[model samples]
Target: MKRLFLVLIPLALLAGCLEVDQHPHWVKGQYAGKKDDLPFQTHFHRDRLSWWGTISNRNQHQNEYNRANP
Candidate 1:
């Protein structure tokens, strides 16, 4: 019991520090399945049931431009 707690505690703390590196150009649509020509700034088709696309954020200058113009 003591050994298990020691191991689990450190692992839990390390897990909190880990950040997942998901790319910006990956968007999962909300319409059941995939669709072509999403209004996102840039996009990629993922399989056939989803699309990977770019989203505009405070730091994404180009994405902001697309949103403003589109």
Candidate 2:
């Protein structure tokens, strides 16, 4: 049981390290196993933020048009 626990624990930690919470483009361009991948990290969060901003702008523009016509 002790041996099994040791092996499983290491495997779980390895799996955690493999997982990254960022876009592939960001990971490849910015991170990519470089030592300076921390401070310059821009990934899925940035992508999502930009997307949300675009959507909000579009919605605001649509509302303005509707108000002007109505």
Candidate 3:
């Protein structure tokens, strides 16, 4: 049991050190609008206000006044 644990522990630690790419290959500039585009440009657009709109919409859902009184 002790020998098994000693070998497994080192293998587990080495596994964490391995580099892994979580994103799909197409995300690495293989698809349209991915290459030559600033990251999060759509989310931070001035006219659309995508990020702000999402936050405000979420807040509205959480607001007590917006919910039906129990």
Candidate 4:
């Protein structure tokens, strides 16, 4: 049992090192879509009065450009 574990342990460690030099498919640009484009995009519309008010208030808080300029 001890001899078997010693041989198996080195083989397992060496197997992990073999993958160190290989790059993943995604990093090599194997997936579709433009490189600069977001993976997902969402389009939202405010159809309700409450939603409109909430989104509007959130946008105001997030509007750094106006706050910075003012």
Candidate number with greatest TM-score: 3
Query: Across residues 1-70, which tens digit of lDDT does each residue of candidate 4 receive?
Result: 9999999998988886756555434646575445553222222342466666767898998988866865
lDDT of each: 0.55, 0.66, 0.73, 0.64
lDDT by residue (2-69, candidate 2, tens digit) is: 99999999888888787667754456457565454432134334366676777778898888666596
**TM-score per candidate, chains pooled:** 0.29, 0.28, 0.31, 0.28
Off by over 4 Å in 4: 20-70
Candidate 3 Cα errors over 4 Å, as ranges: 1-48
Task: Assess the local accuracy of residue 37 in candidate 2 as a C-alpha lDDT between 0 and 100.
Answer: 41
lDDT assessment of candidate 2: 0.66
Against the correct fold, how does model 2 do in TM-score?
0.28
Tell how far residue 52 is off in model 1, in angstroms. 24
lDDT per residue, candidate 3, 1-70, as tens digits?
9999999998999987879877655655665344554434655764446766877899999999888787
Q: Clashing residue pairs, candidate 3? A: none
**Over the stretch 1-70, how does candidate 1's per-residue lDDT look in tens digits?**
9999999998999986779876444447444445556433244433333332223234465565666955
Quote the lDDT for 38 in model 2.
31
* Highest-scoring model, lDDT: 3
What lDDT does model 3 reach? 0.73
